[model samples]
Target chain A: MVEPLRHVTPFWPAFWRGFRALMPLWLGIIPFAVAYAVTARAAGLGVGETQLMSLTVFAGASQFAAAGLFAGGASAWGIVATTFLLNARHVLYGLSLARQVPLTRPERVLAAQFLTDEAYGVTVVHGAREPGGLSFGFLLGAELSLYAVWNAATFAGALAGAVLPDPAALGVGVVFPLAFLGLLVPLLVDRKAVIVALASGLGAWGLSRVLPGGLVVLLAGVGGALLGAVLVTRRGEA
Target chain B: MSVPLVTLLMWLVTYPARLLGLSLGRLKLPPFWLAFLRFVPVSVFAALIVPDVLGSPEWPRRLVGCAVGVGLMWRTRNLALGILGGFGAYWLARLAGL
Candidate 1:
């Protein structure tokens, strides 16, 4: 069955609004791509393999996990398994977005390729303010802008990684954590958020040593959320 | 199997996850579940960043980068400035032969 557009907004306004909405995200996105490509390169992936992964794979956490696991001498099957498990959340994201966005089949197929945590967040928030729940043009703009920046940044990093005598000598590796930190810092607004962040950060730091790469993320995310819940209920809201 | 096929395999693993979810008829998640998910991004980012910044063998350099990044982010609330400062600080530290 074909779904109709939810609202009557003009295409250009919605599209440009979607494009403009993600401008703040480019900071995290750019450094993120650079960090991943350089990491993949330092892990001994060929420039072609590194660029291809960003072009096709496009999931940050999985790409990072694969690079780290590859560096640790993981088998190909193991890496692919990790990729699937890490990406399982995208399933939830799509379900949520589809109900909100009203995408037709072809659009859903195209949209699925660019779906990620940031894309989902921006679109949902932007959609909420629209007269209807969502707009196709807005989503198109957001997804395409993000897709363009992410790939361009990734390819630049790959080329830079290939040419740099030592990516380490230039501190390329620091971009990963710092880039992530840049995104996370603004969100630490309350005790609950702070607790969740600390708990997850410490949990990840500890769990990473014992568990496989993907498991650390899952367990830490749950642990942090659970801790935040407990803290929220234990005390009155500020 | 050829090794360069790994990225293709990664695509195979990921694409269907989203496609399948989108195919599901309009579904409404429970309220509590939605509330809980509000914390996912912060937790996930922290979880991902901590191990990378602190657990890596290159912690000292990453720590410097993060310190600068956080300091600038705190002062400016500007994502671009904070990230660029972090990169510059890291580069300077490395250039100084740290």
Candidate 2:
């Protein structure tokens, strides 16, 4: 087991690579964060409330889902239920990181705070490519930068909502999906992946008609995973 | 609790779950669950994106945007470029009265 803090290169190359890896994704975060703030505030949250949600929950999709329900005049319990349902996916992240990194209790606490979708994906991809300890530096850079930008965007959006003309006309809400789609596009490599993507997509659409809140997301994801795994396994047998 | 208090409360509450998972790392997690864990990001993301691409009510325009986005992302492996293609296609179709 490598010590977690062994590599200490105080140099330009590491900084440059880390910056390159993170900046594009971080740049796109501004619109999404701003949208979240505006929408959350619009949904009756004060500026402080909006910032609080982002700072703590930091789960973009769940927050948005919560805000949408809030805006629709859903009960507070309804809002909580929706957010909980949407963020149920984080449980998977907790499990994966647990096996890979034998963290102390304190480290696990920090890991949960830092493990957003982008951060986790980047961390896992780098971990696969190189030793885990060395990759922590890169992961930290990405995660910290995201933390700063996301909070900053939340603040800005809240401020803007207090002053600016309507953001809806510009389709500010759409930016969230656009940003996600950007991330999603890079990962669809193989036939199985494509099939899973399509299946999940269709499943979510069909299920959402009957299911309330974020159950559709959960159902589609589970369905896709089962389908993809079965297809991959059958292919291996052949 | 107030908003900031709620924020702090959530952070504090989730802390235990994180720590528990970490400390229990030594215990063997179920293999099938771990395997499923590997694909959660992509799978969850797809569940979110597909519905958007298909555009809730405007089917034709949304389909076009989704196609363009998926195609560009496939060819360039540039996420930004793919997003631009999809978003631009949507706007263009809207502008052309589609």
Candidate 3:
């Protein structure tokens, strides 16, 4: 028999449960984090600066873009602008999850610090499955684990820089896309989802041709969401 | 500007953007808007993966890896196995000179 939903699970178990849930995602993140470290080092960032960026900034794509631009002698303002643009998607993630994960103001700020693509993905899955509503403990656990792994991997890669062979040659580049695909395929539950996903993919690809980095993704996401909203309303009416 | 200053600027712009939505938690969104937000994850992931998959230097290997991943997830309903299946497949394909 199914047990009644508890208003709260014990903190420790919920934390560990969140940690374990994200272990699979860690597989992909491990390599990606290492690659970022290596690339940052290669791009002329000092060890201290690279580690600091990983520790503080914590956004992957923006970190990479910033490092590349820095290497190319792009102005600091340009780098900042690009990074800001790339990370704009996080607002969407934060918005989607805000109401679901109930937390005090301070707790929300703390949780927002660890919000990444992987954490948000795991949290969404957890929110949908957990009958007891959003578990702040679970979110903390997952975010902390990813955070720990990412930093550790980055430090390891920085220390091992120049010795490591090209990540692309070893197929490490594919890990991220496949990881995302792993998360995505499960969510394509209906015709509406499939259509929205396809349209978003095509829209992003087309936009990438003319748009600056990150803007393509932002625009495509908005377009896709609008399409999804329309489809949902039509389905409801039907 | 110094590296430290650059890093600080990056953090300033980036961090606040992440936190912006959280501050608006109390504002009730319309159902249509919420439904649209529900699709954001799917859209975001799709946007992330499609470009890389299509533009991969080793398309055959990446394609096979993705297939292995999806197939594993479908069968086991397990995220870890799916990641491992895809990661392992990509490496195997590279080793096989694909």
**lDDT of candidate 2 at residue B3, scale 0 to 100:** 44
User: What does the lDDT read for residue A231 in candidate 2?
Assistant: 70
Model 2, residue B10: displacement in angstroms? 5.3
Worst 10 residues of 1 chain A by lDDT: A229-238
lDDT of 2 by residue, A147-177 (tens): 7789999998998877765655554444446
Report the TM-score of chain B alone for all candidates.
Answer: 0.75, 0.66, 0.90
Question: If chain B of candidate 1 is superposed on the true chain B, what is its TM-score?
Answer: 0.75
Off by over 4 Å in 3: A1-6, B95-97
Stronger candidate by DockQ (2 vs 3): 3
Candidate DockQ values, in order, are 0.53, 0.46, 0.69
Rank the models by DockQ, top first.
3, 1, 2
Q: After superposition, how far is residue A45 of candidate 1 from its true place, in Å?
A: 7.0
Clashing pairs in 2: none
lDDT at position B40, candidate 3: 94
Report, for every candidate in turn, its global Cα lDDT versus the true structure.
0.77, 0.65, 0.84
What are the models' TM-scores?
0.77, 0.81, 0.94
Q: Which candidate would rank higher by lDDT, 1 or 3?
A: 3
Which structure among the candidates has the greatest DockQ? 3
Model 1, span A1-238: residue lDDT tens: 4554345768788888888877767866876787788888888888788888888888988998899888888899989999998887676567656766766789788888888767766776567577655777788788777888988988898889766455455555676676667667877888779889998999999999998656787788767866765666555431
